[model samples]
Target: MRWALVGLVTFVLFFPVLAAFFILLPFDRDRKHIHPLISFWAKAVLTVCPLIKVRLEGAEHLKQNGTYVLVANHQSIGDIIAILHLSHSFKFVAKEDLFWIPCLGWALWLAGYIPLVRGDRMSGKRAVDQASGYLKRGVSVLLFPEGTRSPSGEIQAFKVGAFKLAAEVGVPIVPIVIHGTRDFLPKGSRLLARRVQVTVKVGIPQQLAAKNNGSVESFSDQIREEMIQSLKSIRSQFKTGELVSV
Candidate 1:
């Protein structure tokens, strides 16, 4: 019931902002104009959810003016709010199904978020192409290479599309490690819980060189490795029960 209310109030309160963003769609081709409003909505949601506290680290590594393909592990629906807290303006490479949602979906479309139809080869290629265009235009796009939320909160193997898009655009890749969202709202459930400390680590951007053979498989593996180490470091904190002071 708590999460339900959060969702309801979030939509109700933010509906006007969403409509305004939609009206500005013509001028928000790069999504730069609407990002701050989106950030405000996301931050508002987190503020209303008293149980979740976010601690961000390594954000200094994110350059204020640099463009990147930001990749992160997806643990639960809450990851979206957590990532938005970073306040970095990036369009999310989201699932096509999400675009069908009423107001929220319309807002995403107006803001230029790219959507991908899972398991469709053609849709994947189109998504990569769309993301490439956004990158070339000096906009960063966020991709969850895991493709879906982790049922076990374990970082899964990455898909190659994000790396491929990065290589195609010749931009650096930024790996973001997220921890504890699963405990806040587990997979397949909307129940909200409190006192959950969500930690986010933004690693230094990495420039990936596409191998001569042109396959980004190795590049994807390298990023997955780096994120795995980050998650491991965060898990150790859980054992100690001493949350970092942010």
Candidate 2:
């Protein structure tokens, strides 16, 4: 029943919003104007599905007018929805297949989000170039450095692309850890869980310098370790009810 309501909302809002996006494109060349609309759409979807609750913390770490290379651990499709609740404006580095998903894909393209073809060197290079351009233009770009969803909901080995992009563009790397989305909508399942609490913890932005001596791989590992510790902390806080949902 919840899923039906969510779908109904999406179906009703998707077309009109998409049309508005197209009509506004000529005036919104930088695509900055589209993000807030997308964020609103995401919020509306979440609002209709009362079963999935989202809590966000460390939002203070994000500064207005700050460009970031935002990295987050991937758990499920729900992670995207949960992250959209953030007030920060950013472009997502999403998989190419997601760009083929009807209205959702079209919206992504029109919004100037980067699409990556996994395992394709040329595609990855293109995505990096595009994301770097956005950062250079003072827009944040979000990527799941794990490259794909972690089936077991554990922090997987980090991929170096996100860190490399940050290093290239000289932007701060902000680590965001999301928990409980794996249970909300696990991989390989179309059905949403009946009730789930999703928490997103945004960590302080770490500026990349010569600390790793130009070794993006090592830097990526360092960031991943910090996120691993963050995940542990979020779980502990959730259990003890230490976090205040915002």
Candidate 3:
């Protein structure tokens, strides 16, 4: 019943907003207009679906006008919804197939998010190049460094693309960690849990060293490890019931 209600609400709100997005596209260069609309849509979805509770931490770390190569660990589809709560303007590097979905995909295209075809070498390079272009133009780009959601909800091996792009464009890498979303909407299932608490922690933005001899692969590893540690800390607080919602 809850899932059905959520779906109805999503469709009802999505169509009209998508129409508005289409009309704005010709004048919406840099996607400055589209992203905020998407953010509001996400917030409204979360509001109507009371079963999911999202708690955000370290929001103070984000600067209003700052540009970043935002990186996060993916757990489930709900991760994107949780991220939308951040209310920050950024373009996503998403899988190619997602761009084919009806309303959602159209919105992604209108928002100017980059698409990546899995396991295709040229596609990988193109995604990096497009993302780099956005970063160069002072727009933040968000990427899931693991490339896909971890089936076991564990931190998977990091891909070098995000780190490489950040290194090349001289942008700060902001690490974000999300937990409890998998419980709300696990992989390969559409049934929503009655109640679940999701937490997102935004780490301080770190810039690559100007003279570092380490490869981008190594830097990716370092960031992944930091995210692992942050996830562990969030889990501990969850168990202790000490988390204060933001």
Ranking by TM-score: 2, 3, 1
TM-score on alpha carbons, each prediction: 0.87, 0.91, 0.90
Best-matching candidate per lDDT:
2
Q: Write the per-residue lDDT of candidate 3 for residues 1-246, one digit (tens) a residue.
A: 866877787778787677877798688778767787777777777877868878889988888778899999999888887887787789999899888976677778877888999999999889888888888888899999888988899999987878888888889899999998888788787787557788989999987764445577767777889999999999898679797332
Q: After superposing candidate 2, which stretches have Cα over 4 Å from the reference? A: 210-214, 241-246
Q: What digit string (tens of lDDT, one per residue) describes model 2 on residues 210-229?
A: 88787888788889999999
lDDT of each: 0.83, 0.86, 0.84
Candidates 1 and 3 compared by TM-score, better number? 3
* Clash pairs, model 2 backbone: none
Candidate 3 lowest-lDDT run of ten: 209-218
For candidate 1, write residues 1-246 as lDDT tens digits.
777766776777577676777687676667687877777776777777668878889989877678999999999877877887777778898898777876567657766788989999999889888888889998899999999999989999888878888887889999999999998999889687546889989999987754524558888898899899999999998788766522
lDDT-based ranking: 2, 3, 1
lDDT of 1 at 155: 93
